[model samples]
Target: MKYILDFDIAAVCISCITLFLFYERKQRRFGPGESYGRIAWTVLLSSVFSAASSYFANALPGTSGAATMATVTLFYLFHNSIAFFAAVYILNYGGLLPVKKTMRVLLALPWAIAIAAVASNPITRLISYVDSANVYRRGPLFFILYLLSTLYFLIIIAALFFKRSHYRKSHQRAFLAAALAPVLAALIQGFNRGLMLECFGASVSALLALITIQNASELMDGQSGLYHRESFIEFLAGAFKKKEPFTVLIAHSPELADLQGSLEMQNYRALVAQVSKWMFQASGAGAAPSWVGTGVFGLLFSRRLKSNPVGDLALKILDLADASWSVGSLHVKVPFKVTILQCPEDAADISDVVDCIDQIAEVARHSAHKKIYTKFDFSVGKHKRSSAVAAALERCLERESPELFYQPVYSIARSKPFALEVLLGLSLVNNEQAFQSEVLSTAEKMGVSRQLTELTLKKAFEWHAANKQELAGIDQLQLRLVSSMCLDLDWPRTVLKTAADARMDLSKVCFEITETTVSRFGNDLAMNMELLTGKGVSFALDDFGSGYTNLVKLAPMPFSIIKFDKKIIQPGLQSNKGRQLLEGMVDIFKRRECAVAAEGVETEAQAGMLALMNFDHLQGYLFGKPMSGQRIVEALKNG
Candidate 1:
């Protein structure tokens, strides 16, 4: 039987090219780098051995039978080994590989049996033997090698079938083609041994594995040189499904947002690469970190109880972030907030983990300095609930059915409610203030703050219009407005038009802006306030003393009222210096002709003290909790 060396030579060349490509590729440690590595090398070896066996079998005419036998044996050995390695790779890729040593050994038993049968072939003369002319010939048990290859392909197919949901359609096709290529080539060679197609099939499988699994472009972030978000999610879901315990350290850099386009491209890449490399090393998990968002990077490492305390890890990460990074001529300090989440311990699944990451990253973006967010600060359940409330609120806003409640701001001197503060109510969230914070933050993130403001304004004006008699005694109807609305020059016109459409009295309306908003957009907000103030709309500085508020900046603003946050009022009730500070602020506002209102006045003592301090409007539970418009009308009528 004559053997063709042309196909063998071509297969060897293709295999070499595949192996070279795999070697030169940028490999991610967390991916199937090692598995694809073995496949590449093994396929190259298989092709080389197959070509050598063909050479020696026909070329070593009537001289050295030992060389022919050895080469033939090696060709079959590596050919079978290719199938074995590919099967292991697929199993691991599907996250079906057993973690236990015993189970892993059981999984490898068939490949081990194939190795044993091939090794004992020279004496037993069962697989391949050198004939009298030094030509390779199939033995009695030669089909055993084919059977083993078929068995591995079957296992791969079964895994692909069962784990179909785990991978995308493109990946499923790649896996299927990779597994089927070798089997189809084997079938072709099995029917005609002279065809020499097995090595070609091995080359095809190597190319597929290299392109699809080993060095896939989707697995990496171009800027950070880390795994991308989709890859991270897929890896995390696999871990969750396997029930493997791990800890994730998610760090977000707020400075990255500011430094985005300022630095040169090379410097930006270098900075991101430096941070990613440092994070991967700090994780100690031998896996690559991932770029989850613009400034968010997530490090998922194996959980070690004794060695790796999540708190200490978070501190170490924060400390590393504190170091100054030199990017070209720029010496920048990128602040990072690290949040720690434990698998199965902190989160129920991958969805919860993702929600927790978003919530913490959002908090980190707003925070000023390096901080660590632990499970205690923001738990999975709390994040999920906040997410649920945000989702529900979004739906409500879209439907234009946002629920609003009114809380009375009682007058200390007149002993009557002087103002009604409108609060956005969410039955999903228990606390009124928390609900407002969530709505504002959610609206900002969802890019619907303007929609929320417009809806709330329209609703408040309509309520006031319908119940004009009930609100006649109230001096002001206060509405909380987000700062983004003030950035628009036409925001005042929009507010006035909404009030006009509802036929509500604009003089009876007061818009409240948080101290944080005033500090951020003081110039724009002041202009908007002045515009609205000229049209008989009052502006109140809400949540004063709870954020970064500058007194000098506040003086230039046209706010008619100052509502102190509970953080200030509660502390004022506890200490003498706090009371002095409160009195001084009140006196300053009084001189400015701004009516100072004390919020969160829950008890008689708080109300009495605030009243004594000459707080014109006293608010909180002492006056009345936030109630619906109808309930507010009833409360006012009953009083």
Candidate 2:
């Protein structure tokens, strides 16, 4: 070989060795892919075949020249064929190759034919011939086959190159470049014999070495340094494989996108990255950390610890990362919440970890200010108390444990009761105190908020049905329908059907919806309300001005009654601005042929004020606290 060629070959060999060493190191630090394993086997196989072919070529002198040439040709063919398969395997594993079976078969056919041809050709005359000088000289067919194989390899590498280019991560590109270098070198060598191809191989090996070094550095830094979802999943798998009793801590920066658009995005991202680093460090003890999503980071541990890992990590993150970073000087701080999943206790597989993290992220997204961390509790009891309140609410439904109390709405002009607004009361079975908001919120969560609303409506309807003769003079009864239940298709249909079967006068029953429910459900409220109102049932917007009420929602909905929320009426009955807005709303409702009821009239002054403001009805503790049917009946009779 010429000096340059010798140097080139030495460089190629060195590159291959470097790549092999790097591959070994990476396999140790991370895990190996099936394709990596196959490629390694192929490299070993190709090297053996190349050596055998070179030896046979050198040996084909004078005696059995044809057979020696043929053996050498066969070895070359087998080596190249296996190389093609290795390329195919790598591309397929990387999801770069077409997955269609037909496409794969078509791609493999050429290499398969070449292998078959070489195995069948006993004389090897197709690729080489023994000249009278007893030297094995290449035939035209040999060059053609070489060109064909080289072109095939080039096509495969090109496909992978294009595929890798689409990926955003720098590490992924480096990995792909490392994997493709050998194939590119082999292709260059097939077309020309000189130092160029060998130089290419050396350069490729150097790049592969860089990839290994960079990844190792990242691993040492406790960062998987893989910026792709695939890498995170692989890391998770390894964590499970090692049977590490680790907790997966998921932190979501809900305002990430918003921050990105703001002036503070750069600083915000830096803060988040810093927090992520601290969180990983705080997790400590064989914790394999990765950024699983744009806003999510995951940590895998080898053993479960007694300490509250999530809380500790969260505090560290809050300390290191500016938890108070604001966007655009708006003083709006993004909420950061963390969820911890301990191995075996939280999940047994990577998928379970992912799911738990997602669930926690959802919870975190809804968390109030400063409520930053939560743990995945599998105990049916714990979740029911916290996240799964709705799930356990079925027990409450069976007992009909919720009671209905009525507050009378009195007509201001006649000084007579016009309607009674029904409210839900949940007295716990064990005399345990529970938040009314929680009971209702749990019902909403459990998807039984509608059921509870319907139950309240049913009890009120039953009371009215039995007392219709005694209260025959009364024109209407206002029953509070949770705005959530009004949005519930099933519950509304069932309630309406039950009301229809009872032959209850629809005009006498006014369905009231709370302001909070209206804001939460929004346009979702319209459909259920329309269904009931179309049946002659009057609808009331209860607790107006307390939620995101606007003239727009009221204008479109068939609200025959508007009940001012207590917040709007209390401490504001005397305020001119408050009264003006209320009066304006009442005026708007009155123009639409609606009656307005003022709620929370604690004093005769408040009532007198409301009566003068043209409120059609008034209600409050001043009139009566929500009382039992008997008390309401007595109050009506006495008045």
Among all candidates shown, the one with the greatest lDDT: 1
Runs with alpha carbons beyond 4 Å of true place in candidate 2: 1-278, 286-319, 322-392, 429-438, 483-493, 514-536, 637-639
Candidate 1 ranges with C-alpha deviation above 4 Å: 1-29, 32-193, 216-241, 246-285, 289-398, 401-403, 413-418, 425-434, 463-475, 519-527, 547-558, 628-639
Error of 1 at 294 (Å): 11
User: To one decimal, what is the Cα RMSD in angstroms of model 1 from the true structure?
Assistant: 7.3
Clashing pairs in 2: 390-446
Tell me the deviation in Å of residue 305 in model 2.
Answer: 12
| Cα displacement (Å) at residue 566, model 1 | 2.0
lDDT of 1 at 330: 82
Q: Could you tell me how far off, in angstroms, the CA of residue 121 lies in candidate 1 after the best superposition?
A: 14
Candidate 2's displacement at residue 149, Å, is 70
- List model 1 lDDT by residue over 102-141, tens digit each: 9889778878888888888899888878767566678998
lDDT against the true structure, each candidate:
0.80, 0.61
lDDT for model 1:
0.80
Give the range of the ten consecutive residues with the poorest summed lDDT in model 1.
25-34
lDDT of 2 by residue, 1-639 (tens): 211334334544654664566565443233323234444444444444444444455665635775665556655564555446545644543445655679878887777777765665455566666678777666657665556566665765565566765333664555556546655775767576423343444244344534552344544323333234555566676556554466566666666535556546556556555555555556653454566765566665445455555656666655534555433344445555566666666666765666655455456545546445544332223332443344335655897655667777788877877777767655544444344457677776666777777666666777788899877767777766665665545666687676776667776887777766666776667776787777778878887877777676566677888888788888567688977877787787888898888878889889887877889988888888888789888877887
